[model samples]
Target: MNWPVFFTRLGSAIVFAIIMMFGLLYSHPMAIIGLALLIQFLCIREFMALVAKIFPEAYFPSWLTMLTQVAGVVVLLSVPLLAIIPGFFVVSFILPVLILLVTILQKKTALTAGFTALAALLYISIPMACLITLRGGAGSFHFAIPLALILMIWMNDTMAYIVGSFIGRTPFSPISPKKTWEGTAGGALLTIAGAAVWGYFSPLQQYHMSDWMVLAFCAAVAGTAGDLLESKLKRMAGIKDSGNIMPGHGGALDRFDSLLVTLPFAFCYAAFFMVHT
Candidate 1:
């Protein structure tokens, strides 16, 4: 292992964690929204850059796609779900139509290009919307939900890496060969234990130990899938890292891939239980 690279990565992660804690834990509730939006923007940009590099022939309008993503986020954040649902339907189709029109006007015939923009909507925008919704859903002055969700994701990923490095023998998947079942299981167990411990000390006690364990389970599984999905995308793109945004961590997408998928599932679990019970 490259000690220098490892230290660089570790240092960067520590700085990021401090910033994230301050943003989510210390700042106002609206800071979560701002942070989420900022994350969404960076992730979308990185993803778009990856797609463009991988599929140069694919005629995707980056500016328009970014605009559409921002528009979707705004609608979801500002409007009620009832109104947003119908608006999303119209907004969804409009992008593809615009893509087609742009292709025609440019004299390029790439119908599949539109799908890239749509994929961005599903992959990045929707999950981010879910995160924002989850943050604001459980009533006012409750930023802890999002904070806990992030902490669980970070812990799961960190533990999996540590456990996998030390004792992981069985390869987990072809996409992420470094991952091991042993590591995955160990990480998950630790995450559940951590969640239970958190519940014991947490003043809010929004969830019981059982509930926290369940949520941790959901986060671990979904976070792994999310990590693999990005790996697959990167493999297809023939790239080692998504971008050089982070020295050892690769890019924004690389770091948050797990959280991207984990958030929606965690949000659903939180919404169903916390809102109703």
Candidate 2:
């Protein structure tokens, strides 16, 4: 085993656990927003680095880009001040367009600018907004849903690695060479088991076992898709990792890829079931 990688992963997990504790205890909207902002900024930086590698001549000032992206987040997160639905639309859709227009006028590479801005908006901000929405709502169970999603993803990833190492006969995708069909099945089974265990302990016992099972399955599938999508991007950029910020993990994007994809679905599930109930 690689000690360096092991220690790095341990440290990262500690920090994540601490932050999640804070979010759970405080239920402070701003704290969740702050964490989301930090993630968005880091993800955007990693994406910009990749874009720069692809389009060396592109002149996207990092600080300015960061500021705009963060501002957009602030605007989006303040949805209750106006109407959340419209605010979601503007921040998730319109802000990216406006940023792209500015980048185009600045004579940056259209393709790079467009992709970077759009990715920043969609990949980072949208899911984060879902988290914020979850945190703001009633019931501690809402928060548990996100936590459950994270746990399921971790379970899936761990099972996939363990199973893939031995019985992995079929590649899930060339983009993610290490992923396999056997691994995926093993991971899904493990995730379902984990979800059942979690549901047993959860304070909210209103949800049936079937509901928990479906949620776990959806989270596992979405998380895998998210991981594969990022792998594809990194492969296209000819980069080994998205960024060096996270020690064992490649970057914020690498670490939170599953969360990014799963959060939206989690939010929808919670809204439709838990919130309504």
TM-score of each: 0.83, 0.85
RMSD of 1: 3.4
lDDT of 2 at 7: 91
In model 1, where do residues sit more than 4 Å from their true spots?
A: 1-7, 27-29, 75-109, 137-141
Per-residue CA lDDT of model 1 for 1-277, tens digit only, reads 9899889999988977876776676556566666667777778777877777678776665465566565556534542343536565465456555655664465363444555655666677767766666666434325677777778888998999999999999999999889999999999999999999987887875557776777788888998899999999898889988876777778889888988888778777776676533
Regions more than 4 Å wrong, model 2: 1-5, 55-64, 78-94, 138-141
Candidate 1: deviation at residue 97, Å? 6.3
Error at 108, model 1, angstroms? 5.5
**Native-vs-model 2 lDDT?**
0.73
Candidate 1, residue 103: lDDT? 48
C-alpha RMSD between model 2 and the true structure: 2.9
Clashing pairs in 1: none
- RMSD per candidate (Å) reads 3.4, 2.9
Put down candidate 2 lDDT per residue, 146-247, tens digits, no spaces.
Answer: 666777888889998999888999998999888999999999898888788767776676666666777798778999999998888888788889887767
Looking at model 1, report the run of 10 residues with the lowest lDDT sum. Answer: 75-84
